[model samples]
Target: MKKLLYIDANVNRATSRTERLAQALLDRLRANEDVEVTTLVLEDEGLAPLNSARLARRTAGTAAGDFSDPVFAYAKQFAAVDEVVIAAPYWDFSFPALLKNYLELLCAQGVTFNYSDEGVPTGLVRATRAWYVTTAGGYCGDYDYGWAQVDALCRLYFGIPDVRRLSAEGLDIVTNDVDEIMADALRAIENEPL
Candidate 1:
């Protein structure tokens, strides 16, 4: 079965426009293939940030060739997925801290990636594609730091060759119709390649 990981970082939960758009995208993707979707709601996951102690444990575990800890579970799942979808609302030029924390745990050196013989970093993830979906109250334009960061990480670290982005911007603009904006985003999602 094709495994698709859905990482939800929408703090608003059910009321989030980004989440709605992401669901539409996922629905389209599912229709194109038989996929087993695993949803990780960051808000409900209670994930802790990587502190010094956690880092040290991870390092020690790697050096000892032991990955049986629960801390490495996320990285293991990430490496085995076939695709990834991250949905978040644009806040303060980025996504929430919860998503960052999740990424930190999943970016284990020996789990998600490793150094090659030439000293260059090589990706060990199995995912072939990833999509970052976000909603911005205002025009993101060239200042979309959240999407940019996710794109870079997917390509550089996760070995995901195809990375795409879906966004709905200007939802908070007084002159713009929010429903119309969302409808357009949904249409775009439906038309996106699976």
Candidate 2:
């Protein structure tokens, strides 16, 4: 079975519209293939950003090719997955800081990526594709910074070329019907090919 990593970052998962949409996508994907999903609920994982002391340890571990530390768990897991799903709500034109923290942890050298002979980055991640899901209160037309950043990192740093963005936007628009819009988004997820 394919190992699929699902990173959940919805702040209010029990009633989060973003979470519901992502679950639908997950269900559809599972129906089409045999997948073993490993979910990392960001809220449950007490992840911290890299600090001076943490950076020093990370550097030492990477230089010595010894990632036995618990800090390397996220990076190692990220590199070992065959597919990825990142679900976060759009806040202030980008994703929450918790997702950023997780991404920071995943950017470990010699773990998720490494330098080539020419000093260029070559990804070590085994994932072939990643789906970024987000819900926005307003239209995410030209300023979809969250998706843009994720796509760039996947391609430029992680060597994941098949990055796809799935979003449900304008849910809070007074003129739009939230339920109707959500149903349409569900249909889109069902019809979208894996």
Candidate 3:
């Protein structure tokens, strides 16, 4: 079965619109009938932050020899997945730092990617596509730094060209048109052909 990795970074379970929308997107993707979904809520799983010890191990050439702990296991899990979906609310002009940390772990050299002559990167990730789902409080306008930047990183740095984004804005600002904001996000996910 094709593996689909869903990474949820929102900690607020009670009123997280981004999480809700992500779930909706996952449902739509799962309807394809050919994919198996594996959801990881970051808040619940408590991924370990990349510390000096981990860095030392990586630098000392221990990362390649170790697949015994959850940290290394997560990297393997990420590498084995067929697709990846990242869902996180926009915070301080970007995603949660924990998601970034998780990404740091998953984007390890010699695992997720390799470098050839002239230092050109070649990705080893089996996933042909990645969907980034997010929502922001204020309209980021032309300077949308949330998913747009993340998508680009996934494409350029990670070599995943099939990255797509679904977003909604002004959710934090209570307005009469709140329903429309949510409806648009759902439609965007529903309309995705992938």
TM-score versus the correct structure, for each prediction: 0.96, 0.97, 0.89
Screening candidate 2 with a backbone cut-off below 3 angstroms (N, C-alpha, C), the clashing residue pairs are: none
Tell me the whole-model lDDT of each prediction, alpha carbons only: 0.90, 0.92, 0.78
lDDT of 2 by residue, 116-194 (tens): 9998999899999999999999998989888889998898899998999988889999999999989989999999987
What tens-digit string does per-residue lDDT give for candidate 3 at 64-127?
6554545565667877888899999888888888787787777666666667777987777777
Worst 10 residues of 2 by lDDT: 144-153
On residues 20-47, what C-alpha lDDT tens digit does candidate 1 reach at each position? 9989988898899999999999899899
Predicted structure with the largest lDDT when compared to the true one: 2
1 or 3, which is superior by lDDT? 1
Q: For model 1, how many clashes?
A: 0
Error of 2 at 121 (Å): 1.1
